[model samples]
Target: MPRPRTAPSRRRRIAVDHGAPLVVAKRLALVGAGTSLRPADPNRAYYPLGVALERGFVTDEQHQAGIAYTRAFAVGLRRPLALGIASDQAEVSDERRAELTIAWRLYSAALAAMSRRIKDDTDNLVLYERWPLWLLPGHVEHEADQRHRKRVKLGLDVLIAVEPKIGLAIRETRERRGA
Candidate 1:
């Protein structure tokens, strides 16, 4: 009889720089990407946000809060909050589109602020307390998880490309660190 194959182990650590604006930007980008109201599919029932919650990137409370925030934003705009298309691919008037854009910007800012709070919580108290159950031993990294990570990376890339100021700041920080 053939023996069963075991999965390879992945050892990773999460580190945050509280004082670096560049880090904040990257984290904000990550959160923004992860929390996007993407379509829910069989492979991704919750899409990006669910992945973030599953991967220990964010807490359950935070995930729920994000959902509520997105819904509230949609309601404020007088739009029917539907899944996926409602937030990501909805067709709306110019004014409604502008409102959506502003709402997303504000949400992104809130995500950035939350990232800052997590970083500033020194002593790793919050980190230790919120250590995700998924990171425990015997946890297997699935293909879905890999896809989620890639999506977040792509989002970060887009953010850097679109925000010249953030890109410049990151470049300057790298130069200063001789990286």
Candidate 2:
């Protein structure tokens, strides 16, 4: 006689539960639609909508201030590079620099296709678009990813794909439940 192997199923209950990581690699903040729609937050003036993980609202932008519409055109520009750039001691090899230059030109051209949606400034709300400096062309392959980033920066895709959603959601719950 042999024993049968059983595994937990719809009818079975398990004592242990799998949960989100103890410490996420990065913290996340929910943005747009729900809470942002209710009231204008003054904190919005500090960081660009679609850039770094740091927090701050950004009602205004400037190149000098290090926050603004800079990244918004990331989809439009050529993919800059580190490998072949000219240097004082040893200027980048002509062949490599030329190659990178052509590559950059082609990259800029490629942006034309996705530029309409990816490069639009108005599309920014909760986060700035993943424009320049933040993204490079050749380094990033695939059209799908570009669009996905665009959606994320707009905060229109994941609905605040972070932990803060709990607080906002709870507040909304209390408001709805009136308790």
Scored against the true structure, residue 28 in model 1 reaches a CA lDDT of 45
| lDDT: worst 10-residue window of model 2 | 63-72
Report the Cα lDDT for residue 62, model 2: 21
lDDT of 2 by residue, 1-179 (tens): 89676865744666664443421212122222224434333233233352222222322232211221122122113322221211221344444334334433332233334454532432343223334322331344467755555543443222222223434544564566565
Worst lDDT run of 10 residues, candidate 1, spans 122-131
- Residue 160 of model 2 has an lDDT of 22
lDDT of each model, Cα atoms only? 0.43, 0.33
Off by over 4 Å in 1: 1-48, 51-83, 86-90, 116-137, 140-179
TM-scores for the candidates: 0.27, 0.24
Clashing residue pairs in all predictions, respectively, total 0, 13
**Cα deviation of 95, candidate 1, in Å:** 1.8
Clashes, model 2: 13
lDDT of 1 by residue, 1-179 (tens): 99666555443455665676665554444334342454212232224454455445555565454454444345435445433445543455554454445544544454354454323221021212222323333458787645544433333333333344433544664576566
